[model samples]
Target: MTESDGDQPTRQRWILIRRSISGPDEITYYLACAPLDATVTDMVHIAGSRWKIEECFQSAKNECGLDQYEVRRYVGCYRHIILLFMLVQAFLAVMAV
Candidate 1:
């Protein structure tokens, strides 16, 4: 679709729906922006990965206190995340032994 200025075309958006097999009334919807040639499977894969990423973040928050602090600067935030992940990695490595 054209922008309000009518000078450029806007990127296309697609909405995908997932329904639970056991509960037909339960539904999940995802809004996505992808290339014109992207397939349904591609979109599904990309959307499915979001859950894993979210789970990782939640795990970090719960297990490593990832969200326990606040930083006002980019460098501070970066350092915090690096340290947090290092702690997580060390913990995982010890658990693997």
Candidate 2:
């Protein structure tokens, strides 16, 4: 693709779709197109992966007292995050049974 500053049509993006599988007999979707050059399918897949991370952040903020960490140092932040990850893993493990 040529980078033309004065081109509007060349700046457009297209969307395409495809089927995604989650589990047995379970099918989902993905999208793809060309223009902006990123496929919608890939975008959906990326977003789906990130959604779990977003949920983890929300859970940490809401339930793990993550905001209570007052120290601005990198060590403090890392310590807090490690502790929270351990706590979340334990919580999920317990819920699995």
Predicted model with the maximum TM-score: 1
Candidate 1 local lDDT, 1-97, one digit each (tens)? 1223275544456798988799999999998876656778999999889888788767777667778867689897787775767578568758979
lDDT tens readout by residue for model 2, 14-93: 33343455545555443333455555565766757865877776677666666665767899768777576658856975
- TM-score of structure candidate 1: 0.64
lDDT of each: 0.75, 0.59
> Candidate 1: lDDT over CA atoms?
0.75
The TM-scores of all predictions, comma-separated, are: 0.64, 0.42
Q: Locate the minimum summed-lDDT window of 10 residues in model 1.
A: 1-10
Per-residue error (Å), model 1, residue 45: 1.1
